[model samples]
Target: MENGTNTQSEGKDPSGFLSKIIGNPVMVKLNSGVVYKGKYFTRELQSVDGYMNIALEKTEEYVDGTKRRSYGDAFVRGNNVMYISADS
Candidate 1:
């Protein structure tokens, strides 16, 4: 049972998933609860070091679901990233 599940999951390439959304707008949320929205940059995602470099066009620092601050273009490290999702 476990082997079957592992094979099924292994068949799905995470990089393939990321490639599909490259160049599209994406939202990145960090472990710190900060969110960044911008066009997904594919080049940085290829980094083997696990450092996510986002071409930040907008950012929202959240504190208990409330936005505390906003900002423009910036780059974020991958270690802090919690998840990346496609932004409408």
Candidate 2:
């Protein structure tokens, strides 16, 4: 997990498929302590450029220590992801 580095090698499952069971909408925990809820999309198991692609649709919410914040639809790339978890 390099800072601002999106260099993923080939033959690697960049989507972290094993973390999600059936490609359902899950809570993805990012390195920034932000929990993003979105559906899993296609992954590149062998790509040097684009490692992963998630069609994430984030929501607007308010935290305890902060005011309301908003998020929108995104075509999130691979390097932006840290880890994913299914929302059970």
Best by lDDT: 1
Q: Least accurate stretch of 10 residues (summed lDDT) in model 1?
A: 48-57
Instruction: Tell me which residue pairs clash in candidate 2.
Output: none
Q: What is the lDDT of residue 67 in candidate 1?
A: 72
Residue 51 lDDT in candidate 2: 46
TM-score of 1: 0.59
Tens digits of per-residue lDDT for model 1 on 1-88?
Answer: 2654565655344565566787777777889877766765456555524354455545555566677777665577778888888887
Off by over 4 Å in 1: 1-13, 42-49, 57-72
lDDT of 1 at 31: 91
Tens-digit per-residue lDDT, 8-57, candidate 2: 65226534444434446566555555556654443421232344445555
lDDT of 1: 0.65
